[model samples]
Target: MSSGDGRAPGPLLLLLLLLALPRSAGRRRAVVNRSIPDVCATCHIHATCQQSGGKSVCICNYGFVGNGRTHCQDKDECQIGASKICGNHTLCHNTHGSFYCVCLDGYRASNNNKTFIPNDGTNCTDIDECEESGLCGHNARCVNTEGSYMCYCNDGYKLETGEHSFHQDENNVSCKEIGCGSPPEMKNGYIVGNYSVQPGSAVHYECREGFYSNEGKFSYCTENGTWEPATLSCKEIDCGKPWLIPHTTMTWDNSTTLWSRVYYHCKEGYYFNGDKNFSECTMDQSWENITYVCEEEELFSNLSIFNETCVRWQKKTGRLGVQEMYTFHVQGQRWYQKNFFHEMTFELFTHKQAPEVCLDLQPGTNYSINISMVALNFSLLVSMTTQITDPPFPEVEFVAVKGSAPLLRLRKAEDQNGPISLYQVIVLPLDLQSTFICDSFAATTFFSNTTDIKGYVAAEFQAKDVADNMSIALGDRHYYGKFYNAPLKLGQEYCVFLKIISEWNKVRTQSCVIWAQIKNLSPSLQYMTAVGLGSVAAVCLVLFLSFSVARSCLHRSVHPPPAAVACEAVHLSTTVDVASAGIASLFLETESVSLL
Candidate 1:
């Protein structure tokens, strides 16, 4: 049967039967009954539940639930428990078996949650909303709100972009803008606005018009970014063309500017401005700084006569010669002494007439006279003077020897005059001594061949005068003799004489005597013959020894020896054949046959 609730009666009956068993069995039945609910509810409950095998069984409080499986899920407590779990200033959030707290409205969760837990007070945290974009104005500060922020600019500042606040951090920052003034202006040759006028920028330099900038162009900035250091100069300063001065010629080209050359010359009578010959123009537009003068030409006379002074003769000191004369003029007049006088004899006349008289006085007959003139009117008188003359005939002295080549020499006594002429030399042999005026000088050289004449040989020299008068004789007699070929006897005496011839046929002679003795020579024939014999004997002995030694060497070389066993085995040999059989036999026989 079944229970009234439509439950199966079998389960109920089984329950009763289990209970009717013994006490221990029945207690065991009750325990099994209790385990059945846990197992059954595990799959059907939420939250708090017991798990049976793979199923969960529990029931959770509000905002918490669980599936019939193992896991539990939370409900949005902030939405569902808004009024109860969280206060007005907080929010609540649900999680598995719990709820989170969060601030609401102007308040925020202290723990940073969006929901609040039941009975958990909410903490309202300050919100730094100023960190968000657009929270601060440009050049302004930002303030945080409960849930928002506000922007405000600083005093005396404005935003770059017109807005309550700039959205970006970089956009909100602002700085003052810098502006450039006007650029400097240039005048004259230069144009304005040529350079940039920005602050701290520089303006370049340039020249103006005909005036070149001495330095760089002066530059200054105006209030409106315009600058003009100073007006560029345009004043006219001309370098004029150079000009030539009077009586001067310029050498420089017209195109030259700084330097130019000008040459100046003097007129016929006037001098140059500087040097008499030339002048130059200077850069200061002035002529040569110096001057010169010219003088007149000097005059010279063609002919004039000055006074004559007395002059001593160059060749003769106090006297003069007849052939020498001195003639001079004074104011065109000739003065001289006429007759070889010792004092001045004056005569006045013109140059032509004076020269005529001088010619007359200078004739050949007056060669010994010397004349000279003194101051204008003074005349030097002179006479014929003569110097000492050398004697015409030269002295003759000489010596001669018989049978010898005799020489005769003539010399002047004073050596003042030159050589004498018209002189003759003579000789007389021993046979003609009496008549020996033989037209030759004494002892004049002669040759003889006869060997037996014994007598004095007389020789004489005579000098003839220009009048053809013969001078005294100069003679030299030499005693000589020719003897037989035998040696001359010792202690003999001899005489020799010499004579010289002079002009005018004058002759002078001299003589000398000397004794001569003969000297004997020693005889040496026997000593020479002995030396010859010794030399011959030495030669003959040398020849005999050489012949014997050569014969022995020939004999030894001609003989040969018999061959020996030991000698035949060796290759060495001598120029003389010692290995021959004949030589060996001879050597052995000689050795064995020595003299006993």
Candidate 2:
């Protein structure tokens, strides 16, 4: 089978011929050595070795074309239109030994992959970019095209550059909302506050001073780039005639317009008792209400004092039977006691033309009574003096103790009935309790060194220093104000009296109560006697020991002359005399302590 001008077939061609032989023919030949070279190892990196007709052959990969043994170059699959190679909306890319297909911008593969091959029916489709929210800037709508998206401003909004459509890459682009210029004017009204002309903003209006409005007071911008109609309407103000007042003469002009005034005056024999004398027409379409009043010239007169503590007054002729309120102020003072003062104020209501009221006054006090008519703003002062009387009895808790001094409760005495001058606690012998007189000033203070001192004031407290349930120990030996509380005599029974004195305007009165009765008092008396005896004995022992020490010291000295001994004897005798005097003084002191 030689061709024309045929030399023996080349090596490649011969290899092809051998591969073309059938399997039966290869079986008829002798077996060759198994150490055959691998033709795939010799192929180019980009080429693959494959079996064809029982022989291994080197072939370039799908994306390349070459001789396969030495070189394989990338093939330009994209040389053909991408639409034909990778379907619509795609781009073909050639790799070293392969190729890939990618959808254009705004387009996606049916397999949802970035790159694909059409072999699996994977083609590029248009991507609905609007599905992504805010793909366009605010106030704009996104629209998808064949391979890209566009942004269009919404209604009542426009792009900054006045363009209808824009791309996301233009970051400076924005859809600004439309504005409805300035708001419409309102009749007799003016703008109130600042407002924006953009949609959904409002402009507020207010009526002028002399005008009023009952309609709406605002105009708003509509979404359609127009101002909403304002229903606000203002009208001029017109105030009516002033109101009439009783018993008043009105001085008003025929004109009853805004800011107009009407004057009023009281009739003859009447006085004005109002804050303002005129009423004015105001902006509320009516006259201003006023407090204009007229009252009798003399609301009250003919004031006099009759019953020494009662006052009487007559109302004015025009207001004879009308009910009226009066304020009474009374202040009382004592000439003898500068600090004694009393004052009171009260209101009284009566309809009688001749009204009389009795005053409650303190005894022996000079009082100035002021009766005032508050409605008439008039007051009358009268002087009066009350007669003196005995003060209220003292408040005391009577207590009796048989074995010791009583713990007395000094209840505070109220001075409502009279002025209190002093509080006295007088102690007396039990036998003299019946002879004690509250007015007797013979009782002296505890420290008064006087003979024939039958009884003394154990304590005296001022009225101000006394409290409710105050505890007072009878013989506690403490000072109360200027009075001393001396211990009671041992083995003696005593009576305690509380006396309260009231002295004002040179009038003196007093009340007394038996506060406590202490008798026997054996326990404390025994204890006192024992303490006194022990003190005296201890003193005597000390003095005797001192004297003995001096004698022993003298005796221990060396032998002395007769004259020296006589001098020593005299010294000893003087010391003995001092010791004897000291003992006697101690005994007297003990006895005195027992007598308290």
Per-candidate TM equals 0.19, 0.32
Model number with the top TM-score: 2
Give the Cα error of residue 186 in candidate 1, in Å.
24
Report model 2's TM-score to 2 decimal places.
Answer: 0.32
Model 2, residue 456: what's the lDDT? Answer: 72
Flag regions of model 1 displaced more than 4 Å.
1-45, 49-58, 65-74, 81-94, 102-118, 128-138, 167-596
Candidate 1 structure quality by residue, lDDT tens digits, 1-596: 66689866687689877877777887998899887655444543444555556765465545555553565566665565555656555555566556666665555666566654545544666677666665563456777666655565664444545444543344535522222355444554454446554444556555443444344554654433345466455332222333223333445444322233433443454333334543343333223333332222211112222221222223222222323333442211111121222223343322221222321232111121222322221122222212222333344443433322323344433222222322323222333344433233333333233333233333333322222223222221232221111111112222322323323224332222121111232223653465566556555655665565556556765544445323432322331233343333432212110010
Give per-candidate clash totals: 82, 0
Candidate 2 runs further than 4 Å off? 1-381, 442-446, 523-596
Q: What is the C-alpha RMSD, rounded to one decimal, of candidate 2?
A: 30.5
Q: Where does candidate 2 clash, by residue pair?
A: none
